[model samples]
Target chain A: MILAIDVGGTKLAAGLVTPDGHVLETRVAATPQDADAERLWKALEELIAPMPEAEGVGVGCGGPMIWPDGRVSPLNIPGWRDFPLRERLAASFPGRTVRVHNDAVCLAAAEHWLGAGRGHANMLGMVVSTGVGGGLVLGGRLVNGGTGNAGHIGHVVVEPGGPLCGCGGRGCLEAVARGPALVAWAQEQGWSPGHGPLDGGPYEEGRAVTGRGLASDALRGDPVARAAMARAGRALGLAIASATHLCDLDVVTVGGGLSQAGAPLFGPLEEALRAHARMDFARRLRVVPAALGQSAGLVGAAALILAGDRYWDAI
Target chain B: MILAIDVGGTKLAAGLVTPDGHVLETRVAATPQDADAERLWKALEELIAPMPEAEGVGVGCGGPMIWPDGRVSPLNIPGWRDFPLRERLAASFPGRTVRVHNDAVCLAAAEHWLGAGRGHANMLGMVVSTGVGGGLVLGGRLVNGGTGNAGHIGHVVVEPGGPLCGCGGRGCLEAVARGPALVAWAQEQGWSPGHGPLDGGPYEEGRAVTGRGLASDALRGDPVARAAMARAGRALGLAIASATHLCDLDVVTVGGGLSQAGAPLFGPLEEALRAHARMDFARRLRVVPAALGQSAGLVGAAALILAGDRYWDAI
Candidate 1:
């Protein structure tokens, strides 16, 4: 048995899974605010306390983290700055082994093992949510770069001089296509979920507007909302086209809340991809929806310990 | 002993090398024009005739080719469309191994084995010349995606709506930063090599205006030439920034004739890279000059067989 933990800014989740990719039981809780490392650690402990007797543990979280040292400084989790996650997890688990990887990589491992990327040898698994994240598998091997961060696809500079990204870059795929970016664009175009643009409301972080809300509005034929989703898809398509041209991908599978936009998201995406992709092989690349949905990260974290080198082809 | 052959549109070269990457013998000849496949095969036969007894042969050529069948259809070599290069080469030397790969991949293999990429595990090798070419090594493994064309960095669409490329894509790095692209940009800015644009004696193909010629003018303090090179560097830097962000590369090595422009090219490139790279680790990426110049391809081809899985880890 394997204990898998999925750490996110908004939520924390844990799962007990079998070796063959089955999730037996799962636990979830809201992540704590920036209080202290102890508070975050306590939250994780609570999430993992009920995990069944497992021989190994696997954890996946937002990055700007180190793999070897197992120290994490996720952008959203301020309390986790250089937190020795692996050491603590390993110590808590006693004799069992503990492993950690970027949440996006875990998603790729899950997809490659049992999700939409199952049959493909070279694939890119992406999460287009609050921010875009990705992982790659090439030649049937997980592509971990020198420092285990080989698949930061969201950060690929598509427009070079356009919108400033949250990560301090210009025109990143995430900046143009992720949920926050879409909501920002929609609001800039004089659209709002509330009564009007001047409506008074507190800036509730991570919930001021959601991709699902915008997507529903777009489905309802709201022009402003439709335009934002269309523009987001276009930006995503151009970025994916560049990646396909360079990586010769077999397929690209996208997940996360933003992906719930479905046809409204994928249609314009495929169109932009067709416009930018050049060569015959590159044009053959496909973009599709991910199968596992939210459970992907948890299952993939389990894979890091259970699937072994089959998913973790490189350090 | 290893028999290495480097095939380019303009030239074909062969070499006999030891197991330690030492070239013992070499032969060179200009590539034949619009001739039959047999004519091209004959030229290859002559080039390899004197390659001392070897156990294995490695051939590197331009791509848009099939890896499994070893069929080649390089854009410049119009007559040898889908030529059966591996079959013929195998038949010529029975009971011996012959491997074929893209020339850019070969350059990467050679560099990883004995040149600039020696110590780095995850590296990207780029040839910024007449047309851009690239190869990737991640986690100490050569990357060959679906069709063995994973590292086509030159074609990445950095500027989505900028210029038309030879491959029908707009704003491709090759379209905005290659030798011809730089020359074209300089010409557009009212700089001439010999006489007026209409006074050209003939369309000399790859020799219309070379990167070396532009570099000389730039070094001679011509503002137009300087701006062209600067623009080319910025384009290349943006493309490489995208690549570095995605691949999580440790280093990138630039080769080809244009690389000889030195500071004039590298200065702008480094600046642009610093401008676009956002993540802390991505910002740490370093761009350096390729160590082995012209012979890099031949050496890398030999490495395909000689270095075994060390150089050909992925494909």
Candidate 2:
């Protein structure tokens, strides 16, 4: 069995996974947003402490992190800048193998290993949530780049002069297509959260505007919401087209919250991808929703140890 | 020693190369513009007929070919569509090995093996000639995608809704930055051939407008020509930034005819790259002119056999 840990800005999760990738036991907790490095470490430790003994430990944490050594400083987790994550994990789980990688990369691993990207030798697995990120699997193995940040598609410039990205660039795919960014764009176009059919009832009063709200509104035929989804979708398509041409990809699996928007998002995405991905080889690519869902991060974290030959190369 | 062959739209070249990548002997011929497949083959046969025998043969040919099998149907070469190139070579050199790959991929392999991209584990080697194309080396090995067409960056969309490309796409990097495209754009902006100081003499009469002429004019202080180079440079930078973010690249080497434009192209390229490659890791990337000159394609073909461990993996 392997102890798999998934650390995100919103939550911390741990699981005991069998070698074949089944999760036998799991634990979860809301992440303390204001926690210091030690406190965050303690939260992770407590989350996994009750799990049965395992042969090794694998972790999927948010980036930007130093790979192989695994010092993390996720953008959303302000309290854990440059935290010595892998070192602490190693100290806590002495004598057991420990592997740490970016959560997006982990999500990609799960998709490639057992979900949408399965059987595809050249695939790009992506997530479009609070941020848009990805991991690449090429030649049937993970492409760990110069610094283990190989498939970071979020920063790919999709719009030349459209919007400023959080990474300090203008017109990044993430800036245009991330969940919150879509919701914000919708709101700018005069969309109100409670105006849609799904949010008109008393139970939904005072609900905050969110990407989920925008998706629901788009499904209910809200023009502004649909336009916002289309905008995000187009951005995603352009970036995917660029990636497809550059990598000669076969399959592209998209996951995370916004992907659940279904037709509203995917419709425009397919159209834009078809328009931009014009090369013969690029035309052969398939873009689909990721199959592993919410537990993908945990499964991918476990894959680091269980399927080390393909997913894990860093010591 | 290895026999290396380079097939391009305008020319065909073959060389005898030492194990360390030195070209010991070479032969070149202008490709027949309207020859049939058999005639083209005969021309190639005649070109290399005088070469000394070698243990194996490696070839770099213009693409859209069936890789490993080496059936070629290059876009510029209308004479050969799906020609059985590898099979013919194998038949001609019976007991010896023959390998074939895209010419752009060969240039990348050459750069990685012996030129500017040396010592870099993750690099993108590109050519901006009549067409814009590239090859990628990741984790110190060539990344051959599902169709063995990995690193064909010409089709990467850089300008959405900008210009129509030959591949039936709008706003492709090739459409914006390739030599002919840039020349066309410059001409449309009221620039004419033979107007620059370098082309004023009698010997330069009747010379067509070319990317080289535009670069020369830009260096000699022509506004339209400078703007054209800047446009191409910016497009290149945007594509490079996207590639760097997606692949976590360390070094980018730009080669081919237009690359000789020097500061007129590279100045804007660097500025745009710095503007868009804003990620902390991406900012670490270095974009430089390709070190190898016109012989890069031949050298890279040789590397397919001489450094097969890093460049050639297909059967």
What's the C-alpha lDDT at position A202 in model 2?
Answer: 27
Query: Tens-digit lDDT track for model 2 on B1-315?
Result: 889999988899999999999998889999999999999999999998776488889999999999889999988789999999999988888898889999999999999999999999999999998899999999899989988999978888888998999889899999999878888888899987645445342225555566767777787778888898999999999999999999999999999767867898999999999999998889899988999876788899999888999998774
Model 1 alpha-carbon drift over 4 Å, by segment:
A194-208, A313-315, B194-208, B313-315
Model 1, B204-311: lDDT tens per residue?
A: 555547776776667666788878878988888888888988888898999876776677888899888888887887877889999996688889999988886866
Q: Considering chain A alone, what is the TM-score of candidate 1?
A: 0.93
Candidate 2, residue B253: the lDDT equals 98
lDDT of 1 by residue, A202-291 (tens): 335555477766766676667898788789888888888889878889999988776766777888999988988888889788798899
Best by lDDT: 2
Instruction: Give the alpha carbon lDDT tens digit for every residue of A1-315 in model 2.
Output: 999999999899999998888888889999988888888888888898887477899899999999988899987788898898888888888898889999999999999999999999999999998899999999889988889999989999888997999999999999999878988888888988745345342225554576766777787788898899899899999899999999989999999877867899999999999999888989999999999966899999999999999998774
Fraction of the real A/B interface contacts present in each candidate? 0.84, 0.84
CAPRI rating of model 2: high
Residue pair clashes in candidate 1: none
Task: List where candidate 2 sits over 4 angstroms from the true fold.
Answer: A194-208, B194-208
Which candidate's TM-score is highest? 2
